[model samples]
Target: MVNINEIARLAGVSRTTVSRALNQSGYVSEKARKKITKVIEETGYVPSEQAKSLRLQRTKVIGVVLPKISTETLGRIVEGIDEILSASGYQILLANSSLNKEKEIAQLKLLESRRVDGIILAATNREETLMQTIRELRVPLIAVGQDLPEVSSVIYDDFNAAKTIMKKMISKGYRRIGFIGVEETDQAVGQFRKQAYLDVMNEENIEIQEGWMQQADFNIQSGEASMEAMLQVCSTRPEAVFAVTDRLAVGAMQTIRKRGLRVPEEIGIAGIGASEISRYVTPPLTTIDYQYEEAGRESARLLLEQLESGKKSVKKSVMNYGLLERDSLI
Candidate 1:
């Protein structure tokens, strides 16, 4: 309950001096700082965060908006973000959109309303309204996982990564290849990755069959259903499959095994996202390691730099991806 004034009086220094010592903003003599510290310790005076925010015009908090919260990719990215921010005396305020486009936009406005210092959006889509909302934000904003226009972003090379995996499959003589993809609303995983698959197949002059390309939700069960659908409809089963995500790949693998098909021998399979479980899955999934944690760390660094410099200049960082050629893909 002791105030700054009482601490100042006890320390035999002005309130301004006490404030400078406490906030480490203005210059305070070492002698005066020592006196203030002693008085504060004895009085057990705790500074008010609200008052500090009002004075400094900063909350020392970053807003992080995630499209979905239950994925391993997101968990790793958040870990990286927190690792960086916590070291610099800042914390994150997380907002989950539950993979809803409308909720995504709403969360942005909600975080802004809370007066967060900045926002890091793990964007799933490049909707016009979403981009417009980002453009209109008063606080600095950065996008991760999607390359968006008119904003600073950290994105994966989804197209190239997909192409790499697909080419690998083709080189191994997988002419009859199937694809499992999510909806194109998620531009990074859906549009870019699918485009790469199509381009590779076209370049190789490989004929894509009916039901070879199946769209599914971002879940294991959806992957299972899509693979089953392909088997039921396609006159000739694909020799191999490329799933846009590792979870989907795992599901497809399960379906293939359940149908008495052998992986890498009868039905080779590969996927993106080098999740932890990818290693333990049967035959070990061949996947693209997108460096998700690095993306999160980089996003935090960019936002912090903007906050420190008081500049909202647009900056873009394209994260690197690597192929983990595993047993799943022969």
Candidate 2:
């Protein structure tokens, strides 16, 4: 392992200059900084993060808590976060909740105890206990995909996206539209999005079916079960179905095919998230792109800004969504 003295000798700079450039502490001329950077890069001499943290009183590590790491949406968001944070000399400490809501709460405290500079929660729901914990937190926390009072968030326009999707379904002359949703405790995907669908149905005077609304967890298997249950409940089935997520929508498609029904022709289907598999599905899935990755990048920026500037200002940024028209819906 190359030491700071070797780096300084290679760069023809003093040890203090090398220290300032590596630790981002004190000032160094651009020329000296470039030389120091080149030497560090060529020698692959990485400063000890532990010692740096000790001197700066900062870990330079951001904690990220996610409900699950396997989803395309969550993965993309984390990718975006890493794109920005990694370039800025920060590392991510991940905590997976494994689809357990209580674990999400527990991970927050764990990250705090570890003294991570900031935390970004890619959450499913905004529960009361989670909100209370966030409110009491001294460390900066940004909630992604869920809304909580007095907390900084990078949330989607789920309500409007739902409204728009329902409008499209109505315009396509699909009166009876089934909804595959999650637990209402998940305010964004489960409640806000579902409410918008209901409201739009009401506006268009399209009466929803008693068994058309099905609840499922955020997984493909649960979605398949929910669809089967929904069909069993309805004497006359819906002409179309709108699932809260692409994974769920794909699962519904699987069930539809197993039952000898063709998608979009027999039963139109749509979903949100615009997952990578959405386009490759048999008929392709018409879904909403929530720009989740951009949300992650924005959240990282928000957390870093406050951490670097030592400013405590609450910021709630609602990101935009786009309709992805594909063979499934049209």
Candidate 3:
């Protein structure tokens, strides 16, 4: 593609003069305009719509970065975002990081290069490099799932949600409870949720066995492996388990059933993220509903406010959650 720089070089004029000649919005000498026109005619250089939008400083597009694209939770969130953004005549440009920290930062920079009106990131980890990159963005940005410093965020009450579920589990007279979580780099799902479980267990005066707490990745296979490792290493088996995500919980259930254990009878299990498949499992899974769609809508709404008002204002929205009591944790 013949860009304005090439056009400028061919025309013996600056890029700014070429832009001025193309848009006719600024003063351009007749000699320079003729030179640019001759270059355009020779090279067949028609300016792209993206170039025009960049000149005008309005693309009417929002960049959305996700940790993974296949999850139902993220799908619902995108649905909500599209619901609001489409009404405002803005389109979404989606980029998936696939849960890689480096890829997350790279995608953010790529979106910025695209010159989208704004960006909404469903962030996983709050690493310093990622946070610094967010701080340096030239466009308005909103973060989902993690509370980033000085940045507008839409987050779930992860600590309270986990604590509430744990308290309920304790109320059922289950002292030997296990936990499956991700790395603490992810502030919402990993650190806050794990801390809530620890607090609840400490408050109830329950002893957490050495192998009772295990870390796993976001996938079901990792959940199964983590659970199996827990069972192998622990001298005393836990009566129940709390997984940080529904997929992980489902994986744990698979491992338990494979060992001829009955759910909620031999081993009770629950997870966060109220995924659709959680309901249809042989024994329904109990999980927390984080209102994923609502988070998306709210984040979009805030970004629109910044765009419309031409102001970058910092705001924090803590989304509500609910515990769905089901057969798994009965």
Error of 3 at 66 (Å): 0.6
Q: Give residue 307's error in model 2 in angstroms.
A: 0.2
Q: Which structure among the candidates has the greatest lDDT?
A: 3
- For model 3, how does the per-residue alpha-carbon lDDT over 235-304 read when each residue is reduced to its tens digit? 9999999999999999999999998898989999999999998999979999899989999999999999
lDDT of 1: 0.90
Q: Give me candidate 1's TM-score against the actual structure.
A: 0.86
Model 2, poorest ten-residue lDDT window?
48-57
- Tell me the spans in candidate 3 whose CA falls farther than 4 Å from its real position: 1-55
The whole-model lDDT of each prediction reads: 0.90, 0.86, 0.90
Lowest lDDT 10-residue stretch of candidate 3: 47-56
Model 1 spans > 4 angstroms off: 1-53
TM-score of 2: 0.84
lDDT (Cα, 0-100) at 229 in candidate 2:
86
Backbone clashes in model 3, listed as residue pairs: none
TM-score-wise, the better of 2 and 3 is 3
Tell how far residue 34 is off in model 1, in angstroms.
Answer: 26
Residue 113 CA displacement from its true place in model 1, Å: 1.5
- Give one clash count per candidate, in the order shown: 0, 0, 0
